[model samples]
Target chain A: MQENRSIPVMDVLIAVLLIAAGVASAMSARHLGKSVLEPIGPGAFPLAGSFLLIALSLLVIWRAVRVGTTKSNVDEFKPRPGMAVLALALTCAYFLVMQLEWLSFRWATVGYVTLLTAALFDWQPRKLPAAIVSGLIMGLGLTYAFTQVLYVDLPS
Target chain B: MEFLLPAIANVFTPMPFLMMLLGTTIGIVVGAIPGLSGGMVIALTLPLTFFMESTHALILMVSMYVGSTSGGLISATLMRMPGTPAALMTILDGFPMAKRGQPGRALGFGIMASFAGGMVSWLFLALLSPPLAEIAVRFGPYEIFSMTLVALMLISAVSAGSMIKGLLSGFLGILVSMVGVDPSSGALRLTFGVPDLETGFRLLPVILGMLVMSQVIGDIVNINQPIERVQTSFRSMFMSMNDLRRQWTNILRSSLIGTWIGILPGIGGTTAAIASYTTARNFSKTPEKFGTGTEDGIVAAETANNAAVNGALVPLITLGIPGSVIDVLLLGALIIHNLTPGPLLFQDSPEVAYGIIAGALVANVFMFIFMILGTPIIARLMYVSRAYLIPPIIVFCVIGAFAQGNRLFDVWIMLAFGVLGFLMMKAKIPTGPFVIGYILAPIAETQLRSGLMVYDSSFLPLLTRPVSAAFLVIAVLTLFWPFLMKRRKAPTAPAHLEDE
Candidate 1:
């Protein structure tokens, strides 16, 4: 049987994103104009950097196409995309709650910690209590330490 | 020399001394836990230093650097998992030795080797950095620009993964650094009309996001993996005089090797450990005994890694150039404290410079004592559940971001960079070069622009100036050296170790 090999989808995606960023940077640099005192301008470095990035990204695309991806290129740990996405979403919601000033730092953090900890623990029945307790301690403890001891002005 | 006494006095004072003790203890315990890194902890701790005296902050961070480099031995020996990348080599012999019923002996050898390495490198850090700074002080804009160029090139060339990918990551970082208003002109660029982007991304948010948040995300994914630890007693944790006598040469040689690698910009303790381990095996009379529980392997690896810690500090203190990832964080710390790093740091902030040197020595001694007495307790920390650890770390990251400027906008920047960092990790693009590029871009651009003005818009001075020319040539060679070695079919260190 012929061995299966495919293009590295991730590398290609990264290269495409880089190319777009490079193009945007070049456009921005063009509008920034040159410096009077020096031959180089505020835009010179970024312009040059953008060109190099585009070229290198092209090279990445070519390499991925020619060499193809192997099984070894994959990470050893099995990626749980579901868990990762959930974690990220929960984090974002927590941030939104804080951003809107819906709750104080302490309570928002307590909710975030409890939910994140429980989610990370796979929401098992036995571990929910432990997760909640941990959330309470971390939420209260960090708030006190940062505000009282460290004097950091967290959102009240 | 005049600053030596004051520096000693600064570190020996009650506050700084106590901070060093606390920093070293925390560093060791955190380092002993698998999946946690010294860089992550230090980044999380950066905001807490906002209210500290700069000297005290430096002492605390430097002590943590020393302790974390030595702490990985505990997990590497007992659980066969390197708590930090620096201990990757230690797992080879350390685990087998433990399995063979000599766990304490293995740890004893590792601790002694680490102490020896620390002492040897401390001498170089004290004696060598001063003169190196003296030389660096005389460098012109062209030379400084070339040096930064070489550092960037060296990191991309040596980082794991394709050279193109590393270069791309670095260039992306440079672009990210360009997002705020142009320093020379008052015009805003790359902000895309967002008012929050006016200041660009602050270093604290970017670093906290990249180093801490990304790792926490990965940890949560791997939270369910079981750990099987090898239990051992502390009875045999002391090395005999005979054993020290027999291993002295290996210890010295590996220490020197590690220190040399550490001075080279962009390489870290992991590379030092790998190189020393390979060299030790090559030089041993009974080389076959290496992988199956030999003291030589443990000694060389532990010694080189710990030695590299101080070795890395040399360049940071003298040239304002970071030698490794952790050194970049230290550079950030120095910058955050309103103290500029570089040769002038010696002239302007001599106490802080010498305080770092003194703090390293004191921290090493503390690391030796702590590891000797607290190994069993520290090893137990490796078993802590990630479910509890990851959430607190995220909280710290959030607070660290917000505390930078007391803005919710900074927290969002932290999350955005966290996602970018996580994607970069998934894509196998090394983060080290990205950070180096981010930190060095302003320096490179400023120096190069200054050089151009001095030379009347001619780039010829870059090649005509001797020091600048030499730096550019070395940069070219470093960029192509891997290809040359590959063509010659020479043995190389494992690719995974290069990422650290």
Candidate 2:
């Protein structure tokens, strides 16, 4: 079979996103003209950076196309993203719960840690208790450390 | 020298001593763990330092820097898995030596070499930084501007992966840093009408998200990967005088190489170790013995890496330029304490500057003592379950972000940067340049504008000014040196041929 010689999808996506970001930044910065005291103003730096970003992003796309796809590069990305995504979601939910003032920092953290740890533990029946205990220790320990020792005002 | 006694006295006081002790212990434990790094631990600990005195906080962080660099040898020797990137070269000789029923010997050599390196570089840091700061204090706006440019370019050029990607990451960082109100003119530029962004993203949230949370996500993904634990006794954890006598030259050479590399902006201990290891192999009579458990190899790698930790501190204290990724966090710590880093720092807060120098020496001593006494316990701690560790680390990240501004908005920003960092990692674009660029952009911009204003907007003095011109030339050369070398090495290409 012929080798698959296509540009990496990730690179292409990244390049596109960078191009968009550069364009957006440039557009936003264009209106802020130069300041009187200095010839170059606040917008000048960002504008230059945006242009360079666009140029470098174009180069990235060119390089990716020229190099084509390699087996090792494809193999290198064998990440189990499911667990990572779940962790991120759980973290977001934990933050939301705290933001909503649904529970105190201590309790909310305990629940968050327990659930996340249990999930990460792959929900093994034997490991669930260990996870819960770890959660309690970490949540309570962190709350005390921050509030009492460090004097950080944790949300109630 | 006058500042040294006061600094020593300040550090030896009970509270500062305890904090240093605690920081070193924590740093060692974290460094010995495979997935955790010194940078992540320092970033997470930064907010906690907010409550402490600036001197104590700096002492704690500096001590952590010393300890973490020394701590990587344990796992590298025992398990053939490097605890930190700096220990990478150690694995070649260290693991083989351990496998041959000499684990303690490997670790002993490593620990001694680490101590030697730290002691050597601490001397350089103490002797060199004051004079370097004297010269740097004379720098004009144009000179400073060009110097910052050189630092950024050097980092991007030397960073792993594609140069284009590194530059892009750096530029993106600079752009991100431009989101708030312009410091000089007080004009809003890139807030996008969000009230939260009017003040801009603070350093803590961005750093916590990128360094700590991203790693946590990665840990979660790879939590199931099996680790092979190595068993060893603590009986032979001390090297003999004969061994030290034999390896003295090798240790000295590696430490010197490491210190040189560390003093250069953006490069860190890993590079220092690699360079030293290569130099050792080249100089060795028994070059063939390198990979299969050579004492010289272990000595070279460990000594160079530890030396680099102190070497990196040189530029940070003297020029306000971070010598490595971890030094960037140190710079952030300085800024958090409202102490401006650079030559002015030495003038205004001689205590802080001298404290760091004295603290490094003290920390090295502490690191040596701790690693010697606590290796067995640390080896056990290194294998702690990720299921428990990851969640707590994430919670710390949340609290760190929230504690920064006492707002959930900062936490959200932290999460956003976490995802951005994770994606950047997947793309193999180094985060080092990004953070450096973010931190240095304002300085670069302000200096350039000030220079321009002084020169009547001509932009000619940037080239006409000898120091600034020289720095700009170095920046350009650094950026293109890789491509030049590539062209020279290409068998089929003409010497004048350009890369795409």
Best by TM-score: 1
TM-scores of all candidate predictions against the true structure: 0.95, 0.95
Chain B TM-score for each model?
0.96, 0.95
**Residue pairs whose backbone atoms clash in candidate 2:** none
- Can you give the lDDT of residue A131 in candidate 2? 88
**Segments in model 2 whose C-alpha atoms lie over 4 Å from true places:** A1-6, A73-79, B481-500
lDDT of 1: 0.86
How many clashes does the backbone of model 2 have? 0
> Could you give candidate 2's per-residue lDDT for residues A73-124 as a string of tens digits?
3332345689898888888888888889888899989999999989988889
Model 1 residue B123 CA deviation (Å) reads: 0.4
Would you list the C-alpha lDDT of every candidate in the order shown? 0.86, 0.85
Q: In model 1, what lDDT does residue B81 have?
A: 86
At residue B459, candidate 2 shows an lDDT of 87
